[model samples]
Structures are given as C-alpha cells and as structure tokens.
Target: MAAVIDLNEDVHTLLPLTEHRPIGTLPFAGRYRLIDFPLSAITAADIHSVGLFMPESERSVQDHIRSGAAWNLDLIQGGVFLFPYVATRDYQNDDLRARYYENYTQFLRGSGSKYTVVMGAKNVANVNLNAILNYHKAGDNRITTVYKKLPLDRIRPTDWTLALSEQGTASAIVQAKERHDDQGKNEIPSFMDIYLLATTDLIDLLDDAAQSHVFRRLPELLRDYVLANNANAFEYTGYLARIDSIQRYYDSNLQMLDDASFQSLLLSSVPILTKSKNEVPSFFAKDATVVNSLLGTGTYIEGTVQDSVVFRNVVIHHDALVDHAVVMQGSKISTGSTVKYAILDKGVVIGPNLTIVGKPDKPIVLRKNQTVFRESEVEGSAHA
Candidate 1:
C-alpha cells in the first residue's frame, strides 16, 4: 500500500502550540508526538513507502521524523519522502493536493503500489489500516472512508460529518454543525477524514475534480466521489480524539489518566513509534512529594507533583507545587513556584515563587520557550 499524510493547515486552530511547530510534531501522551499515531498505524499495515505533504515547519518535521527509522520506513527503496510546499503569503492548500498537481501525482506514480491511503493528522487514534484495506479489497468500490458515530460537539464544527445508509454506504457529508440538544442520545456519524483508494482511481478522480472546477479540495472532491461512486464507510469503534481546540487537547491528555483509555490508545494492537531520545532514568529528590503522575525519562522532581504528565529532562525545583498539569520536555519549574491545570511546552521556564492557575474548563497553556515572572497570576487567557 502507498500512503500520503496531509499535515493540513487546520492545525492552526491548535494555536500557540501550532504557532511554532506542526501539529504532527506536537508532543502528546507524555512522550509521543501527534504524527506517531498515524505513522505507527501505517507501519503496522506493512506499508513501507510514505509521502508526507508538509506545508509548514519543514525543518521541525525533518528533525522529528528524520530518516523515518523509528517507523521502519528507513528502507533503501520506497521509504519515506517529504514534500514541503513553499508558497506565497496568501497560499491556501485546501484548494489543491499539493502546491502543484504534478507534485502529488508524481509521488502517486512512483509510489510503486496500487492503493493509496490519504489522511489528516489532527485526529489521534490507533486504528488498524489493514482491516480498512481488507474491506476495500473485498468489494469492487473505488474508495472507502473511515468514520464513527458520536455527538457533533465532541469534535470541531469544521470537521466532516457523514450520514450513512442502512446498507453501510455513506450517502452525504456536511461540515459539522452543533446540535443544541444536550440529550445524551443525539449522535451523528463523523468522518475521520481517512481514505483508501486505488491509485488509478485516484488519478482519474483528480482529473475529473480539476475539470469540474466545483471541487478543488480533496475532502470536498471525495464527498462528491462517495455520492457518485459506490464508496463504503468502515465503522471505527476505538478511542478517537480530534485535537482541534485547546480545551479538547487538554481534556484528551487528562483522559489518558484512565487506565482503560490509556491502554486502548497507547497499548493497543498497533505499537506507536516515536523518535527515541537516550536519557537517564527519572530521579526524585528526597524533598519531592509526588503521586499519580506520568513522569518521563530524565525527569527530576524535587517539588510536590500530583496528577500531572511531565516529560523528559524536566526539572521541578524544591518548594514547587505542580498539580493537575501537563509539562513537556526540558521545562524548569523554579523553587517555590505553583502551577495548576496548566500545560508547559518545551523548554519553558517558570521564575521562583510564580503561581499559575487554571480551571478544568480552561487550562493554561504556555508555548515553547515561554517564561513567566514570579508571583504572576495567569488566568482568563485559556492561554498562558
């Protein structure tokens, strides 16, 4: 199988986090990045070749997925290929597959496979593509998409929604809209925006969509394809979290604290792969008081930490209190600092005696390399 990942610009919604890096490289689950879920799924399907259509932060992407060795995509031939799109300020990639049609087509032509799997990375889930591929092969359809039935509010309003027929065929897709009914039974079929199609069929669809001029975006074009052609929908019954908003991001991370949710997503059948960093085991100082937290390698805790996710090489100085927060790699919480319900990105530094607080409804977020002064009150920002 040939695969192409569209690290779409929709990641911009993930603000401050996406401000400095692609969502794919955004740290998740204490250690792994967002892209690891899809890449790991592709590798599990035994698809050796991959073409990443990166439109932003090309350097950062290269650093994380360097040589694709972790995903077993380091093969001599048909390994990993990165296509960085360099366009003008007003450029929007939703109109076309790549900067130019020739670019995407070139990758398709040389992928040396019959089927192609196209996806967007914001949706985090550990799915087995082999099952979806088998469903496509069992039928004579030209395309197959993955979807789940859930409340519309669970995902973003811009996410694609699918209404399926009794026969399991997807009939119509709409830009997700909110339902006012707080009733627990109101659920809609939401598309995961993952597709599998034959290479020849994809080329044909591209030519058709271009000529019609009515469908320029890949998802819109595919929506029409499902309507016209015999496209099927495969129901994905697993943990699905679309990190389109900051609240959603924070909620999803905290949800990982649940053993069932954590086991199903990270310890599922497919092994999630990430760039390995060699670091010493975490050290807890005698002055530390920690409980119910996920601490990564090289993490040094000397403060009071409860119910948080701390990444590698982080330093929590003495007299600090971190409660119900997510702190990324290389962050230093100075002595006498207190951070609650916050997310500290890479290399962040908190001054001595600083106090940052947030509610469960709105968590504080400090971007990469951000610094906070002592005795500061960080509230109402939903962003720190």
Candidate 2:
C-alpha cells in the first residue's frame, strides 16, 4: 500500500512555534518533530511510497526529511515524493482545490498500489497501519477509517467524531461541536484522520470531487465519503494527543514527563523514528539540580531545571531556574533568570536576572529569535 500525508492543517493557533516551520516540523519531546510520528508509523508498516502535500513553505520540511533517509523512504524504486503548492498568477484567483486535485491524482496514479493510506500530521499517535491494512483486507468495505474513543472535552470543535452502527461501521460523521449526548455517553469515537481505502475508490472520489467543484481538503472529503458510503470503523486503542491549540500542545509535551505516557507513546511496539543528529552529550554543572526533565544533546545546564523539556544546544546559565517549560534549541537562559510555565522558541536569549513566568493553564510563548533584555519587552508578548 502507498500513503498520502497532508501537511496543510491550519497552524494559526500554533503560531510563533509554527512561524518559521510547518506544524509537521515543530519540535516535540526534546528531539522528534511532529512529522516523525506519522512518518514513523508509515515506515513501520513497510509502506515505501509516500506523497506529502504541503501548502506553505517547504524549506523546513525538506531539511528535516532530506532524502527521507531516516524513514527508509529514500529508495529509488518507491520513495517519498513532496508536492508543494506553487502559487502562480494563472491560478491566483482559483481555489487551491484545483492544484490539490491535480497533484493528488498524479501521485495516486503513479503509486501503482492497489490500496492507499491517507493521514495527517496533527493527530499524534503511533498507529500500526499494517493491522489496519490487514483488517481492511479482511472486510469487503471500500474504506476503513480509524477512530479513538476520547472524552468530549478533549475533542476540539474542528475535529470529527463518528457515530458507529451496530455493525461497527460509521453511520454518521458529526463535528465535535454538533455532537449531542442522546445516549448519555461521555466518550465519543473521535476520528483519528487515518483512512485506508482501495486506490480505485479514492481515484473515483477525487474524480467526483473535481466534477462537482468541491473544495474540501483530502481528509474532510474522505470524512464525508466515509459517512455517506458507510465505511468500516477501526477503533484505535492507543495513546493519542491531538495538537490543536497552544494549551493542548503545552499539555501534550508536559504529559511526556510522566513515565507511563512517555513509554506508551514513544516506547511502544511501533517505534517513533526521527532524523539522526550527531551532537555531544548534555552537561550539567556541579551546582546544577535537575529533576524529572528531558534534556537533548549538546545542552549545557548550570541551573535548576524541573519538569521541563529542553532541546539541543540550549544553555541554562548559572543560577537560572527552568520549571515546567519547553525550551527549544539554541535558547539561552542567562544567569539569575527564571522561566516558569513558558515556551521559548529557538534562538531566544533571555537576559540575566529576568523572570518570565505564566500560569499553569496558559503558558507564555516567546517567538523565534527573540531577545528580551528587560521585563518590559515581555509584557505583551504572551499569546496564551
């Protein structure tokens, strides 16, 4: 089976962290990027051919997946193909659906596989696509969609939830906002945005969409198709952390600090793979006191770090304190500074003796390459 990865998800809520990169390339868990989870799942299933469609800049994505060597998708026979949307004056006024359909149809036609797997990057989970493929092959359904039962509060309004029939098929697809608790169910079958279907059926859907002038994204289009066609629903009983908002992102990262959650997501049978980086080991000074934190390589820590995730090449200078924060690569917390419940983007330099703190529910976000010398500079920078 071949795979199609959509990277066109909205990132406005994840801005500052997503300013210089796509959501797929955003740093996570000290080392891995968000793209690594889906790509790793695809690789684990031994699916070699993948078509990644991106709507914005490809520089960061290209750099991270360079040749797709990490995912073993660099083969000459069947490899990863990147389809970046190019905006030209000829199609300036036209909706992106035209370009999307053209590129998608081309990729699907060239895949030469009987089945196709469609997925997105925002839903963070280590899914075993092989199991889903086997399940789909056993059934006679045209499409098999994956869903995870989640609490209503965890399901965002933009996310889709499925109403399953007695036969374990999707009878209806409802948005999280429109969901009604007629049966008094606290948890709903939240769509994981992963689908497996016959390549021919996918092509037919695309053709009909083109003919009807529909402009929905691939995932949304597939959602409607699933409900209308009564697609089979495969329940995924695994750890799933949907990264839809800043609060969710922060909570998801911090959730990794728990041993069980970390093991469940990262150390499962399906391994999460990422690009290899060669760097020196992190260093903690003699006076440094670290507790329950994940530190990346090449980091020099001389402060007190607790319950935080610090990325590569970060420096916590003498007497600084980092508590419950996510510090990206190349950021420096100067001596005597205190960072609590905040997210410092890459290349941020916090001046000495400054205190940057935020509440537990809402963390302060510092933009990329921001250098704050005085407290006044951080007054209105919180985008919580």
Candidate 3:
C-alpha cells in the first residue's frame, strides 16, 4: 500500500508561521510539523512508499523531507519521491487534469502497490488506515474515502459536506447548508478531506477525470463518477480538526493545552510521529510566571505567559505579558508589552511597552519580522 500527500501551493490556508513556507513543513504542536499526522499514519500502517506532491515554489519541503528517514517512510518497496512538474508537459493541463497527473504519477511510481491512500497534511489526526483498507477490500469498492460525521446545524452552506444513504453508503455530495436531516436518519458525513482509492481504479479514474475537468477536488470528482455510480464509503469516527483558518489554527493549538479530553482523544491510539527538534528543555527564569500554557523546548520565558503556546526559541522579556496567544519560534516579546488574543508569527517582535489586543471573534495576525511598539496595535484593526 502507498499514501499520497497533496502538497499543493494553495494549501497555505493552514496559516503557517512562515508565510513563504509550505503548510506541511509549518511548525506544529511546538515540536512537530503539520505533515507529521499524515506521515505518521502512513508509517504506522506499514506503508513505506509515500508520494508527496510538492509544488515547485516551496523547494524547502523537498529538502526537509530528507529521504523520509525521520518518519520511516523510506522503504525498499517505494521511496518517498518528490514528484517533478509534469502538468506543463501534458496536454490536458487544466487544474483538474494537473492534479490528476500529479496523483497518477505518484501512484504510478508505486505501480506494484495494491492500494493508494490520498490524504491532506494540515489536519491533525491519527486514522487507522488498516481498518479502512480492510473494510474497502471486504466491500469490493472501487473507491473509498474516510468520512467524518458532522453536525448539520453547525455546517455552513459553502463548506463541503457529504450525504449518505440509509445503509450509510455515500450517495450524494452536497453543500453543508443544503443538507437535509429528514432522510431516514440525520446522518451527515463530512469528508475527512482525505481519501483511499484502489491502485488500478485510481489510475483509471484519473485518466477519466483528465478528460472531463468538471470538478477540481478528487473526492467531488469521484463522487460524481464513481460513488454516485457504484456507491461506497469507509467512514472513520476519529479525532480530527482541519487546521485551515488562522482562528482554527490558533484555537486548535490552544485546545491542545487546555482540553485533556481532546488531548486524550488523539493520543489515545494511532500515535502521531514527527521529526524530533532535539532542542534543550525549556528554561524559565525566576522572574517568569507561566500558567496553563504549553512551552516547547528551547524557549526562554523570562516574562509572564498565561494560557499560551510558546514555540521554540521564543524569548519573553522580563516585563512582557502574553495572554491567550500563540507565539511562534524565534519571536521576541519585548519588555512591558502585553499581547492578548493574537498570533505572532516567526521572527516577530513586540517593541517595548506596546499593548496589542483584539476581540475574540477576530484575533490579530502579525507577520514575520514585523514590530509593534509597546502599547501599540500595529496591524489588523481594519480587518477586525
């Protein structure tokens, strides 16, 4: 078996600490990366040949992936290869076909494999593919995708939501708002934003999708052609969160610190693995006061931090106070400044004595190397 990670350029919606960096390489959970979840899942499933569809812009992703030694994705069967740009060479090079070729070539590289599991990296979860693959083989389905049930009322119209039949088979894909609960049971299945496809069947599907560019997302394209025609789904009831929006990214990180129940949910089974930072333990000065926060290694907290996430190499000055915020690596919180409900990206600096705070609905996002004077709100008021 093999796993494919779509490292598309547009996946930057994950709000990476470094703007130019790819979402998968983005520092996550203080020590791990966003791609760790999916990579770990593939590793645990004993799937060695992992195809990472890296875009040309973010060559750093290719460099960092580094032979997949960190995640044990390096196997004799299939090497973790950074796929080259073939879309431009191919005739049917529209968005849909480009993606098809991208996935197809990656799978083609693993031609001997029986099944291919396509997944997104930004979402933090440990899904047991062994179960899903077993079920798929048992059902004799051409295509199978991992679906998570969603609360209908909570789903928005534009957000992608799945509709399943009485037998729990995915029949129609619809807008979250347009979803009706009255049909048999109010079961709403939302795609985990991940999929599993038969190796031979996926190649055939991609070949067909290349001809017809009606849909962009593979799941939607498959639903229109495969599922709607043949009917199948492998639902996964597991802990998952798509860390797309900035708010969701900040909220999920904070939730990791505060919610034990949520933490247990993910850590309970299918442990997620990541490249070890191998940094020294966090240092807290005598002047530092921290409460209910998760401070990563290599952090030097001399100031006051409350309910926050302080990543590696963060320096909180003696008098600075940070509350309910996520401060990325290599950032400096200067003396006498107070930052609340904000995310300071990598290399960010808060000038001495500045105060920046935003409403809960709209938190502030500061780019890298940007500085805001003490008691000053440098950005995001207009957005707020």
Indicate which candidate wins on lDDT.
2
Q: What does candidate 1's lDDT look like per residue over 1-384, in tens digits?
A: 899888755666678888868877878888988899999999999998898988567677889999999999999888888886645442354455334455667788888789999887888898999999999898667889899888646756677777666787876666666433335657777788799999888877776655553425565677788878757788898888887888888888877878888888999989989999888999999889988888889999899999888888999999999988999999999999888988888999998977788888878888789887743435443334
Which segments of candidate 1 are over 4 A away from where they belong?
Answer: 88-99, 152-156, 178-185, 210-215, 375-384
Q: Quote each prediction's TM-score.
A: 0.91, 0.95, 0.87
Instruction: Please report the TM-score between candidate 2 and the true structure.
Output: 0.95
Question: What residue runs in model 3 are displaced by over 4 Å at the alpha carbon?
Answer: 9-18, 85-103, 152-154, 182-187, 211-220, 374-377, 381-384
Worst 10 residues of 2 by lDDT: 86-95
The lDDT-based order of candidates, best leading, equals: 2, 1, 3
Model 1, residue pairs in steric clash: none
Q: What is the lDDT for 289 in model 3?
A: 97
Evaluate residue 5 in candidate 1 and report its C-alpha lDDT on the 0 to 100 scale: 89
Judge candidate 2 against the unseen true structure and give its global Cα lDDT, from 0 to 1: 0.87
Task: Tell me the tens digit of each residue's lDDT in model 3 across 1-384.
Answer: 877787663555544454677667766666667787888888789887777777545566866677788887666667686765434344345764566565665566555788888887666677888988888877755666667775655344555556666676666666676766746744567766666777777777767766664535454566565445544677767666666677677777777775663465357567777666678888899989999887778998889999888888999998999998888889998888788888888889888877788656677888877776634346554322
What's model 3's lDDT at 80?
83
lDDT of 3: 0.72
RMSD of 2: 2.2
Clashes of 1: 0
